[model samples]
Target: MDGSRTAALLGVVLLVTACGQPAREPGPTGCAGGVPSCAPSTAPPSTAPTTPAPSRPVTVLRGTVQAGVEAGCLVLATDRGRFLLLGGDPTVLREGAEVVVEGATRPGQATTCQEGTPFSVSAARAEPATTR
Candidate 1:
């Protein structure tokens, strides 16, 4: 046989041998022996329920009430910082009133008033007058 004929016969034999073999099943590592570096996963999924963090405590602020630049916006100027009061007694939250307010500071709360931290007022009272 010529060299070409022998090479053709050898190629046909190799193809036939490869086609007759069964495919290998993947190991527990999800990789066939085709990859030598794969390892099986050992960590298990967690089943415990997760608890939410507690809410923040309410804040008390003492300051003189002042109206914001925008109409209907009330602001309190305290030593701590300025606070925009929301949902308090209209009489107690009047402009120029010296008052003590109890509420939570809602930094994320949206408002038309551009000044001061947004405060949701639960209660408010005017400061008692003092004799000189």
Candidate 2:
């Protein structure tokens, strides 16, 4: 066959293949009555959903300061149990005396908890202060 005839045949084949393929349409929209003729989309909406873990409560730990770790953490042991109090001012807490420290008990190491250490309230009185 001549080059022109072969070229024409190839063009026809290409056109047929292109025409056979279905064209993709835009997603449906939820526009109101009798306006743009758009319908609600069957496909689900895309969202960056997140499930945040429940927040831990602020625990008041009353114990003797066991030992001090880095970043103002005192290992405390009370009647309840031993827990690493997130942050404690060294001057306020002593080695043997009883202490009541209020802070959040985070999941991991106490060292990192300093930043998120909820609200710390401490009281160190040898005897309950009485008014004269």
Candidate 3:
């Protein structure tokens, strides 16, 4: 075939191949999503929906009320762990006494309290020794 005809045939072939392929849209950067890729995609943006704050109480730890010897505050020690009492009557809730206390956690509750997470005691009850 002539040079011009051959060039025309090649141009048509290239155009047909390009038309057969699907078009793709640019995708978001992978670094922000940690996907490790930036390949072109037609999909929508990936995102996590915003969540609301919880309405209920944070914690309700069960432990025996112990005297805060080092910190001079009240402390509750249970199998879970130990926590310093923020506001509660330490008179009846004496050391070695089993009690169930419920309250929300207080971050940086008291500087003097030691060896326990700061916990605000909202409701508390002394249990019978027989239950132990």
In model 2, where do residues sit more than 4 Å from their true spots? 1-55, 68-73, 110-132
TM-scores, each model vs. reference: 0.57, 0.39, 0.50
- Give the whole-model CA lDDT for all candidates, comma-separated: 0.85, 0.57, 0.72
In model 2, what is the error at residue 80, expressed in angstroms? 1.4
lDDT of 3 by residue, 1-132 (tens): 999999999888866765665654434543222222445556776677978987657577777887786746778887878888777666546788788787887766665766688888787788754653
Q: Which pairs clash in model 3? A: none
Predictions ranked by TM-score, top down? 1, 3, 2
Instruction: For model 2, state the Cα shift of residue 63 in Å.
Output: 1.2
Writing each residue's lDDT as its tens digit, candidate 2 over 1-132 gives 999999999888866765675543554553433233445467766787878997667666666766544545456666876665544665666566567777665545435433332334443333222459
TM-score of 3: 0.50
Model 1 ranges off by over 4 Å: 1-53, 129-132
Screening candidate 1 with a backbone cut-off below 3 angstroms (N, C-alpha, C), the clashing residue pairs are none
lDDT at 39 for candidate 1?
55
Model 1 has an lDDT value of: 0.85
Candidates in descending lDDT order? 1, 3, 2
**Candidate 1 to truth, TM:** 0.57
Global lDDT for candidate 3?
0.72
